[model samples]
Structure formats: C-alpha cells, structure tokens
Target: MKTGDQTPLICYQEMTRASWRQFRPTTDGHVAAVSVDRRSQLALMDRRPSPSEIYYRPPAGVYWVDVSVHHAMLHLELPTAEGVFAFRAAIDVAWRISDPVRAVKDGVKLCEPIYRPFLERKLRDMSQEFEVGSFADAERHINTYFADRAVDLPSGVAMVRCIVKLAPEDSARNHIQQRTFDRHKAERRNAEHKAHLHGAELQHDWNTTAHGLAMQSLAHGQETAAVEQRHREELEQQRIAHYTSALQTGGIGVLALQLASSPADVSEVVQIMLHQKQLDLESARDVLNTLMEQRLITRRDVQDVMAPISKVIADRLNPTASLAHREPLPELAAPPVGPVGQVEESEGLDEDESDHD
Candidate 1:
C-alpha cells in the first residue's frame, strides 16, 4: 500500500457494483482499512473491514477506504459569559478513526472536520460559563474536560488528547485593559484625597497646639508683670512706713540726720523749727538776757554748748563722719540751741519784730 500526504480518511478507490477492487496496507502499516459496499451497504452496516496485506486482497464490488490518526490544530471562537465578547481558543487534537466502516459510509474525507465541530459545540457550551477575562481558567477547564474523557465525535473519529490554549479576542482584550486603567485611576484619586484630608487634619492640630502655647505664654507674661507690680508696691509701702516711723518716733532731729546731707539743709531745718515755735529776735534776746542775768549760763558756756551742738549736727549730716550712723544728738542740760547771736534774723522776722512791740 502507498500513503500520501492526504487526510486521515482516504479513499484509495471506488468501484462499480459488478467489478472487483483490490488494495494493500499503507506503507506505514498504521492505517486501518475498510470495505464499503455501496449497493447492499452490508459491510458498512456490519462494521467490516477489507483484507489489507501485501499477500491478501480485498473483494470486488467494494469501495476501498483508509483510516489513520491525524494531528490537527483547530482554532475556534468560543462564546463566553459576555455575549458580545468571545474567547479565541487553539486546540491541538489527536484523533483517530473509531469506526472505519462508519467513516466510509458517511463519506468522511477528513478526521479534523469530524471531531472539530463536535468539540466546538461542546467547548462553546463550556466556555459560556466564564467571561473573556477568565481565559486561564477557561483553558484549564477545556484541557480537563478533554483529558482522558470520551467525546462523542461524528463519523467514527475519536478524541485522544486535546491541549487547549484560550485567550480573549482583540476587542475583549482592549476592554479589559481600559477597565483596569479606570480602576487604577479611581484608586489613585481616592488615595490622594485621603492624603489631603490627613494633611489638613495635621495642620489643624498644629495650629491648635500653637495657639494654646501662645495663650499660655501670654498668661505667664501677665502673671509675671502682676507679680513685679506687687513687689514694687510692697517696696513703696515699706519706704513710706520707714519715713513715717522716723518722723513720729525720732522727731525733726532724726529726720535731719536721715535727710540732711549738708550744713545748709540743717540750717534750713533749724529756721523752719524756729518759725514754727513763733520765736522772733526780741524773744531770743530776752531769753539770752535772762540767762546772762541769772548767771545760769555764761557767754562762754553758751558758746561751749553751741560748739558741741554744731559739731554733732555736722557729724550727723556728713556721710563720711565717724558718727554718721550714730544717734542724732546727745541729751543736753538745756533745750536744743544753736548760735543765737550769730544767727541773723531774716527780713520777715525783722518785720515781725517791729510788729511785736
């Protein structure tokens, strides 16, 4: 027998009803031979094969048929869950003649057409369960369904093993790409909004904290100023109390000692005291004449008294004097006196003396 590059089911010869036909096995000897009796159809109905040997020969009045396994790649557009979109599948199928008589009686010329239609119908039904985007799952399902499972193929072809590769069509792929882009864009926008909200909250918190600190600093400053003001007031009160006590307890002498820094101030204080006492030149002369007449105080005794009083006043008023921090004056045998004759009466006292008599 001779084999060419024809299809799996090959017709070597077709004879008339009265003539006889003879054939031999294929060169590869792997192909099955069938005898088809077209008039009575006995061979095809009873599933009979013609004798195929280099030494044997087929009967006459029979059609000679050769059946062999064929490997083919079937490309199909299978329907999916999306009505408009479909999956493109490439199926690698290895099929063979299951019933050779049936192949010849049905006039099956090619094994691919026999099982491809059946596979397409079955795969389309299976693919409708998934969307186009689920190409990988669809591929796995197809391979699993056709793995070692018997498929009812037409015209005596049987499926051996089917390796399927599934993918989305061009339009469906573009649709998936556009949908993914939109989803990512939406997610990015949402993330940016959340970041903006987070930033705003942080800024608000910072402002609040800054405001509170500023208020606290201001309050502290005010409190410090108030404390300083109270301290100054307390110091002023202490000074006033000190001056008042000096005036009440120590009299003009202590006041002079405390305030008088020079002999001129001491003299002014003495004049002010004499004026308050209402003493004029005449009263001073009379007091001196009485003291002279009674001989209780002499001129030299008065001078001696005046001299000590002047020295004491000068020493009390002088800051550098040894007795600067001492008592204002010592107790005297007589009243406080200054240089009466040396003290000239002012013009006002002269006028007052003229009015005295």
Candidate 2:
C-alpha cells in the first residue's frame, strides 16, 4: 500500500458504527480510505459537517468536504411534575451566556456535576411533580422547550434546547406546596441560629457576673484584714512605750538612793560596784541595801551622815587643791637689838653730868 504524505488528512462525519468502519483500509493499495454501505453512504453524502469539524481540518488553505451519519435529536422526559419544574429551574439557573461558545460547552460539562445532581435531588424532594403517564407527550414538551432554550444557549455546543410543559392533567397544587415547604425550612434554620446566639450571650453574662462578684469578695476580705492588722500594730507600739518609760523612771530613782549610802571614797566604790554588778543600776541598789542592813543605819542616817562624809572626801580629792599648794614658803630669822651708838650716847651723857658736878 502506498502511504500518503506526512501531512494528515482529517475528515468529519456524524458518529455511527458504519461511519467508523469507513476509516478502515480496503483491499486496494490505498493506505487510508473511507467507505460506507449504500444506506450510510447516501446519508453521509446528503448531510453537511458541523462548523467545528470544518475548522479543525489542517492545510489551512484547503477547502472542506462535508459528511454525516444519523443526526437525530435526543430527548429526555422527566418522570414527575417536580422533575419538570426542577428542569425549568435548572435552565433558568444556567442562564448566563458568558463567552457563548465556551458557556455552552461548559454548560454541557456542568450538566453531570451541577444540573444532573440538582435535578435528581429536586425530583426526590418533590416527587409529586412526577405524573405517571405517556412519556411521549412529556418528551415532546421537553424537546420544544429545550429547542427554545438552545436558541439562547451559548454557541458551539451541539445541544437541542428544551422546556418543561406541565401536563394539563397534573395538579398545580403540588408545586405551590413544595415552594411553601422550602420557605419554611429556611425560616427554621434562621430561628435556630438566633436561638444559639441568645444562649451564648446569656452564658457570657452569667460568667461575667460570677467573676465580678468573686473578685469583689476577695478585695473586701483583704481590706478588712489590713485594717485589723493596722490596729493591732498600733496597740503593740503603745504598750512598748508605756513599759519603757516606767523602766527609765525606776532606774533614775534607784541611782539616787544608791549614791546617798555610798562610802566616802564613793567614786571608786561606785566604779567597783559597776564592774562587779555588770554596770546595772539594780545591782548598785542591792549593794547599798546590803551595807545599810549590816551597819544598822536608818534611811535618814544614810542620807544625812554618809552623804556629808562622801561630799567631804570628794572635795579633798578634787584635782584643783594640788594647784593651789604650788606657791613657795619664806625662810625663818631672829629679832635684832638697837644700834651701839645710841647706847654710848646715853652713857656719855651720864658721865658728863658727874664731871660738871
């Protein structure tokens, strides 16, 4: 068999069993050939190819040849009035024609994912719309409706538009009832959401009140404890001051009494007493009491007698006396007689008088 040029020869025709068989090689030496049985050949020759197929062929300048197989339109009859309504709804929902060609292609793509499932669910939910009767009339109705729909369908898709023709025999009441049910369901969902929010708000308010009360109680207890503690500290300080004043007064009185009974060398006595008694006023008082009891002196005797002696001794021992005794003493001498001339004069006068006589 002789092979054609590397450039591929593309052809378009309606899909069918015999149409596909035509692409197979025959007994002749042609590498690629297309043949159809008499009936299919006539059908292919009679029909024109679609615009997409015409454009898809290569060798940009080459003209195109048309071919076709069975090109009958397929129709689907919904089983119920609800089905019909849902179909109409779906058609309405898919109304956008953005990029008409692409939208139509996309709408076909969207059929299984969006429209088919939506239609099935709607039919299940509103079963009353399905009327058990001749599907032929329903099919006819759907075909007419879809044809009209396809007129507005985005271009490029090879779909026949359809419509939903309600049977004159079916009741309109079912559709009305389903619409009411849908509305009620929506309202119930909203009510449930609002109730949930109300419950949450109430719980939040309760928690806030509880926390606030707990904090207030804690603060009140702490404040009360602080005030009581302050009062206790003030009372303790007052007690300490009273005891300290009494101790100092008693110490001064005891110091005076001990000094009165002290010995004449009382400074040394007091110093010795301080050392032996650990410099305590109470110990000095004890020493004075012991001396008074041993000597049998009355309190007056201790005051008047011992006190004077102590004073005299203190004055004698004063540091100023030694400084006063520092002046020098005069040397001793005898009394003198009268001069000898005075004695001779008296003797001579007596002799002269005798001679004159």
Identify the leading candidate in terms of TM-score. Answer: 1
Instruction: Report how far residue 331 has shifted in candidate 1, in Å.
Output: 28
Per-residue alpha-carbon lDDT of candidate 1 for residues 125-166, written as tens digits (9 for 90 to 100): 999999888888988988887788756577776777788999
Mind giving the per-residue lDDT tens digits that candidate 2 earns over 215-239? 9999999999999999978965764
Residue 233 in candidate 2, Cα distance off native in Å: 2.6
Model 1 residue 77 distance off true place after TM-score fit, in angstroms: 2.8
lDDT score of residue 42 within candidate 2: 19
Model 1 TM-score (2 dp): 0.48
- Each candidate's TM vs. the true structure? 0.48, 0.25
lDDT of 1 at 90: 90
lDDT of 1: 0.63
| Model 1 Cα shift for residue 109 (angstroms) | 3.3
Return the clash pairs for model 1, or none. Answer: 20-60
